[model samples]
Target: MKVVVAGSSGLIGTALVAALRRDGHEVTRLVRRPANARDEFRWDPARADLDERALRGADAVVNLCGAGIGRRRWNGSYKQELRDSRIVPTDVLASAAAAAGVRTLVNASGVHYYGGDSGDRIVTETSPAGTGFLAGLCRDWEAAAQPAADAGVRTILLRSAVVLARHGGMLGMLYPLYFLGLGGRLGSGRQYVPWISLDDEVGAILFALTDDALSGPVNMVGPAPVTNAEFTRALGRALHRPTPLMVPAFALRVTVGEFADEGILHGPRAIPTALEDAGYSFRHPTIGAALAATVGRS
Candidate 1:
């Protein structure tokens, strides 16, 4: 199969490309920069310009293009950037795929679609989207892919969780803190965190592309859901360090500003219902295993 992946420089995108190559699939990276000798294609979602011919013969198109939520404070401009970064590219990709008659389009989404707070109420594919800026952003992101779906393309919205990888994503931000033995629970430490290993994240994306039965939203998370406190403790244990400190909610808010309140310090429990029912196996379902993998520990 020939696959075109947007956001090819991102953590998940890079991993997904390698995995696809290993499985004997020809991969094309949708890059913003100039193309090199490798399978690189040009695209600028903000400008509504892309190499449509590059997508012509592709079997699957994975849209991982988006601004990083954790990259900066959730100010008004950043929020707009986040929304634009996701929706515009997705719209372009969907339109191009529809025109090219692509078979499958796996659009990346976040668990934020489930709302910021679900309490003990477990979320599924049918769960209502929460009312917030992030939720609204996710809603539009998924909606932007309507053209591909309308074209009879198998469109899968990957609602992923906090991806745990050594090189990037959440793990990259937490590694130095953990290594310094300053790691602790965020906020009140009771929020349920839905997380997935880097390996499983890549696996799930591939599964979505291949599985004809899967469409709509699929939670790309691990089977195990842990509290913020438990996550901190597990990660500390994995690193053989003490997890006695707790960062106050107010302190986080003061340090990171609004993002500390809405994003970093708050999250809900989430599980991958579609993956489990479909018998997809996970390499690191638990936080301990995830931390071990992040630190190169068994």
Candidate 2:
């Protein structure tokens, strides 16, 4: 199948593109800069300008455009930026997919759709959208794909969890601290941390593209859910270091502001009800195995 991908330079996009190509699918990357490569095309979501010519003949459109949520403090402007960053690109693609007659739209979303404070309640794809800034963000983010859905396109919203990889995502930013033996639980360390390895993340995306039964929201997370303390311990074990520290809630707020409360500390136990029902197996089902796979990689 021919796939048109936005945000091809991102962490998941990079791996997805390679995996798609390895499996003999034709992958075209949507870029913002002037297009020069045969596999690259230019599109600007801010202006809502897309080269529809490049979108033609595509079997599916995968939209992954978004700014880093935790890369900066959530000021009013940055919060608005986060909303715009996702909505604009997704809206653009959804509208374009319908116009281009694309069959599928596997759009990106987050586990925070269940809110940052879901605590220990087991969340599934059928679960209603929760509250808070991220839940609102995710709600609107997935709604942007309504254009294609209304146009009769098969649409799937991937509510992804904390992706674990060696070079990017949360691990890239937090691993250094863990490696230096400064890593431990946050606050009470009881909040759940839903996670998935990069490999499984890519694999799940591929599965969604071909699976006709999948629609609406699918939790792109692993089967095993662990507490913050368990995650901290797993990382320390993976690195062969001792974790004898804890970053308190107040300290996190002082460091990353409200992200500490909702983004960092609160945990939602999202299960892959949709994926599992769809009959897709997880490559890394446990946090310890995920950490080992991620850290063991070259």
Candidate 3:
């Protein structure tokens, strides 16, 4: 299969590109900078500028474009950046894919589409969009891909969980702290943490690219559900460290502002119902296994 990937420098994007190439799929990467390699194409999503050649004869176009939501304190400007960063690139790629008649469009989304603090409710692909800024951002982000689906291309919206990896992402920020014995639960440690391993995250994207019956929103999370406290303990156990500290909600709010509330204090109990139904097997099915695999390498 011929696959074109956008946001190829990101954590998930890098892994996905490598996995696609390893399997002998011809991969073309869309870069914001000048094209530097044979498999690279330059694109500007802010202006929705992309050469149709990027998508020509492509079996699938996987878009993973977005600014890091937790990369900065949420001011009005940063929030807008979050929305534009995702929506603009997605719109560009989707429109280009439609124009080139690409067979599949696998777009990135977040489990936060179900909103923060879903409590104990199980979130599935059919679950209605939830409330809050991130939810709205995700809604708009996925909606940007409508052109592709409308053009008869199979569109897959990956409502992905907090991806766990050895080097970057949530674990990256926490690894050093935990290694220094500063790791602990945030807030009351009761909020569900929807999460997935980097390996499975990449695997799921590859699965979505070829699985004809899979389209629409798919929750790319683990089969098992875990609360913040459970995750804290598991991570602590994995690192052979004691998680004895607790970060209060007030402290978190003072530290990271709105993100402290939505990104850390609350999360959905999202499950991979669609992926499981499609016969996708997870390499790290449990949080313990996931942390072990990630932290063992760190």
lDDT to native, each model: 0.86, 0.91, 0.92
lDDT of 3 by residue, 173-219 (tens): 99999999999999999999999999999999988888899999999
Question: Who is ahead in lDDT, 1 or 3?
Answer: 3
Ranking 1 against 3 by TM-score, winner: 3
Q: Which 10 consecutive positions of candidate 3 have the poorest summed lDDT?
A: 289-298
How close is every model to the real structure, measured as TM-score? 0.97, 0.98, 0.98
lDDT of 1 by residue, 100-192 (tens): 999999999998787766876788888889867777888999999999999999999999898988778877888778878889998888887
**Candidate 2 — which pairs collide?**
none
lDDT of model 1 at residue 160?
89
Instruction: By TM-score, rank the candidates, best first.
Output: 3, 2, 1
Model 3 whole-model lDDT (C-alpha atoms) = 0.92
Give the alpha carbon lDDT tens digit for every residue of 1-298 in model 2. 9999999999999999999999999999999898889999998888888877978999999998999999998999999999999999999999989999999999999999999667888989878888899999999999999989999999999899999988998999878888887888899999988899999999999999999999989899989899899998889898888899988888999989978887778978988999999899998989989999998433
Selected candidate, larger lDDT, 1 vs 2: 2
Candidate 2 ranges with C-alpha deviation above 4 Å:
none
